[model samples]
Target: MDRKRVNACIEEIVKARKADGGLKQVFWVAAGGSNGGFFPAQYFMDRESKSLRSQSFTSNEFFLAPPSSLGKNSLVILCSMRGTAETCDAASLAKERGATTIALYIEESKLTEVCDYSFAYESISYDETEASEMNASYGLFLAMVLLKKLENYEHFDLAIESFSVLDRVYRDAWNYTLPLAKKWAERNKNESVIWVLAGGPAYGAGYIFSICNLEEMQWISSPTVNTCEFVHGPFECTDKNLPMFILISEGRTRPADERVLAFLKKHTDQNIYVLDAKELGLSRIDKRVSEYFNHLLFSPILNNVYLRALAIAKNHDYHYRRYMWQEKY
Candidate 1:
């Protein structure tokens, strides 16, 4: 909703470029529900970043794990929109271990003070609960800025254009998916558990942030799966009454996707939902560009949509900033 804040964060990241001293590795850490899940995916797929190594860490016990875990020359980018204490503690530890520390927080806070550098997006809070959406968008901006600093972006203009495209996509998704997502939430309310499916990178995505956070939010059992695995094994004896959500990305996976759709059709008794940019007819991209963005940004957007719907369904009155800090540090 606040494009200016997102743009400002992006600009700061671009301006902060220093020769990363032959950067070798990166530890991209995020705390919170959706961010913890999506940040790693964003970091890895971002070819512009000089991150030879990357991983997502969740457990507090591992937060202090030796910096050598990321290798000698690692840059620790601690991401927490709400400036969670555990993440601040992790940043402090990473810095003490001689790893360069950076933080992406919603505002300048204690976490920023603990890091070598801090990027604040959305300084003026909107609705405290949904602020994470803004925080997530700012995180994406941070990723883009980091790339601009580290890589020779012949496509800087293109990247800016891509932001506009992304904004439009989010708007469209908000319009179209909300009603359907709410409907699905209603239909699946009685189910004891929900299965979320995506494949390949999306497979990694299925477990990354959103679904896992949804588990915490809804207090319902949610398991993520790669559609390929579901077809290989789980699909064999799935009961009709089960609920599963499929996140489809555009690519050669099309044929495989057809197979999935066919299978879901065959098992019409199962409560199933598909979230995809192309499937939703929401993205504006040429074929080549479509394939690329779909592979990267598509699932995260879908995940956001699902999260928003889940928040509404649960009547948690979810305020993003309310959960700003986790107590476990």
Candidate 2:
């Protein structure tokens, strides 16, 4: 929560990139939930910025098959809650290749030491306490600031101002959504399989919820598929008793989500839980900016909080794991 330090670090990055032929590309490098958090930022840059090309890669893949686009004018951002070995190796490689490296971590470790710039946020921890939502928010803020500096984005000020009151928004969202989450958990506690669907930036939320929370934490069968890709093959698996969760983004691809929702409703007698970003009252945020960035701000927190409630209802602990931190990979 050291806003001043974060600002200073971003300022230095901006200054350095400006001096080094004006930052041609940005790579968000990490793995698992950490890499999932970067998706919204990549989506934002793709939609809003013209000059800066943004992409995300898992640490293992980046280390084995380095991108041809990575070079002196590239800004590489690596994130890890615990600063895992793969992340550290990837950061070291990117640094050695002359890319400007920034490490965002919850705790100090080897990855932090290898980067040109490092940021540690005490409020965002690498645990099963539903804190990854806050971590994603911080990630989006850092990405937005970088984009603002590079492109002079018109809506950056409003976005930052809105985020200043995000604590209150988060509280309100939890209060409003917790009851619904609990109800869904109670009803579906015995279900064997679940399908999660999302499109656009909200895909990150779906990925983390299905993979990190449901599958990894609760040991459930939850396969996340993009709404646009549902009809290709995944949609055929739907049945009357199956459970589905849909995360609807408020951006350009919302119509695609709506199309899938309508199809599911018409074809299946199963329960379909829809958590739409438009329902959250982001009172302080501008409507235009909210439409574009609300998925990054709202979806992860909602899904994280909902998954916590599901864990409770299923008589499972969110922190319980078979191999995650209990054994070495």
Pick by TM-score: which candidate is best?
2
lDDT of 1 by residue, 18-41 (tens): 344444556667654534444424
How many backbone clashes are present in model 2?
Answer: 0
Q: lDDT tens string, model 2, 223-307?
A: 9899989989888987888899998777678898999999999998469988877676553456766654555545546456777
Q: Model 1 off-target regions past 4 Å?
A: 1-21, 34-37, 40-51, 59-64, 67-72, 122-133, 136-156, 200-213, 251-259, 286-329
Backbone clash tally (model 1):
7
Instruction: Report the Cα lDDT for candidate 1.
Output: 0.57
* Model 1 lowest lDDT segment of ten: 123-132
